[model samples]
Target: MMLIEETAVPETALPVAQFKAHLRLGTGFSDDDVQDAVLTSFLRAAIASIEARTGKVLIERIFSWELVAWRTGYGQALPVAPVKAIEDVVLRHMSGSEEIADPAHFRLEKDTHRPRLMPVGTVLPPVPSGGAVVVRFRAGMGAVWGDLPADLGQAVLLLAAHYYEYRADTALGGGCMPFGVTSLIERYRTVRMLGGGVM
Candidate 1:
């Protein structure tokens, strides 16, 4: 009765050893980090299930534009509009709620670029499935904002799972492995690559 029930196909079972290795490489927490550990486990399982079902990996791009205007005591300071752009490149491979699938994929792609640095008119790389998912994700950015609510921790876990699936898929597809797991991984990698290793 699940949404993906009809389309679910038996997947090549994920190897336990490989899964554990992936967990180690993808996350920085230890087993003592109960919250992170649990979340990571959930993400891995969800990703494995989704990959087993769909032979093709779902790839997506993530982009965002933010315009803010502040007023000073003076004559408005020429509007002072500051435009910031960010991305959260992600791949949604986990077969979970359909609503999340789109957003998950988007976060994967957006994670690739340096926020507020990529030029406004820069061209983006094409994603699988003709970019439909990416377009939808970008359009839904407003909804994904805010603290990922503590009550919605389970939902966050599901999103994390889809993210992991995307990373595995991209790696298998001959793309460079993401810095770690989700867009956060890209953040860490970007910083390190820029010569800002651990403060």
Candidate 2:
């Protein structure tokens, strides 16, 4: 299976000013604006890292996932949480033909941490001989910064501050999560079920 981001979170959606406030960086400094651009990168990186580790999108964006088959006949568990909508499902046949599944035939069983695509009736569309199914959808808390969970927002600011302070370190290892950041996002880590199902 492969998951690809269809659209990225807009920079405007990032709460840079609020993050700065969290860091206690006063706006009176001459370099405040310059620092904002630099800090924006840190915030974006922190948010991306947190999302990667947690398997949860902290901001709204489109994502497409490809799979050979469903985990169960009932439905397939999506990789990301808080799925807002199922954009479309495309079936690719071994013969190289493609068809878009009718949205009416399937529905999103939205959940806070796990969402699944469930067929409306007894069975889903016929599977292709060798090709895969591509499902596209939107997921996240919301498009705006204020829509983020308070703890998650705090975690992003804390982690970004960490990155900002260590900007001169030059040799920090990748995937390094500070204790506080981990504590904030630990509960969000997704636990997959048997047969590649997500819990």
Candidate 3:
């Protein structure tokens, strides 16, 4: 299985100014925006880290996931949470042909922890032999930073601040995420059970 980011978070949607404020950097100075690029990088890194840890997209964007088969014939759980919509599902055959699955036969089951793609009938659409199915969809809390849950927004800031402060600390240990960030994102982590895992 492979996941591809069909659309990325726009720079305009990032909270660069808010991140700067969180760092409490001095204002009204000639170099006020001097470090904006650096801060923005840290913000992006923090957002990626949080998303990786929680399987939650903070910013709205489209993604394409390709797989040979569904996790189950009943339903296929999405890799991320709060999926807003399923744009398309395409079956790609080894013969170089593609067929778009009918949306009427399938539906999106929204869940905070594990959103799923489910069939209206007994089983999901089948993938052609030696072919793959690609699921394209949009997932995220919202399009802008303001739309994020307060705790998630705070977690981003806190983690970004941690990155900014330790920019040059290469010797940092593997478990570097601060306690506040872990606590803030605790509830967002997906709980895997019964050996059910994303393929």
Candidate 4:
């Protein structure tokens, strides 16, 4: 299985000013914007890290996920949470043929942590032998920073600040996350059943 981001979060959707305020950086200077680029990068990194840890998307974007088969013939759990819509499902055959599943045949089961793509009927359209299914959809809390839950928004700012503070600290090692950020996102993490099957 492979999940690809069909569209990235727009820079305009990011809260650079809010992040700067969270960091308490100096203002009114002619070069106040000098650090804006750096800050933006950190914010993006923090957002990515938090989202990955929590299986949630803070900003809205399109994604294309390709899989060889459904986890359960009934439906497949989406990789991320709060999916807004299922745009299309395309079946690609090994013989170079493609079949677009009708949107009416399937539905989106919305969940905070483990949304799923379900069939409206008894089963999802079957993929041909040696073929793949590509599911395209939009997932996120919302389009703007304000659309995020308060705790999540705070977590992003806090994590971004952490990155900014440790920008030059090489000894920190990899995958290092602060307790505060982890706590903030813990409730959002999905609880998997046997071998990651959603309960």
Task: Please count the clashing residue pairs in each candidate, in the order shown.
Answer: 14, 0, 0, 0
For candidate 1, the TM-score is 0.17
Query: Candidate 4 lDDT, tens digit per residue, 39-139?
Result: 88998998999988888999999999999988787888888888999999999999989989988888999988788888999988888789999999999
Model 2 RMSD in Å is 2.0
> Rank by lDDT, descending?
3, 4, 2, 1
lDDT of each: 0.28, 0.87, 0.91, 0.89
* Cα-lDDT of candidate 1: 0.28
Q: How well does model 4 score by local distance difference test? A: 0.89
Cα misplacement distance, residue 197 of candidate 4 (Å): 2.5
Off by over 4 Å in 4: none
Name model 3 segments beyond 4 Å from true: 197-199
Error of 3 at 66 (Å): 0.6
Superposed model 2: Cα runs more than 4 Å off:
29-31, 170-174
Which structure among the candidates has the greatest lDDT?
Answer: 3
State model 3's lDDT. 0.91
Clashing pairs in 3: none
Give residue 163's error in model 2 in angstroms.
1.3
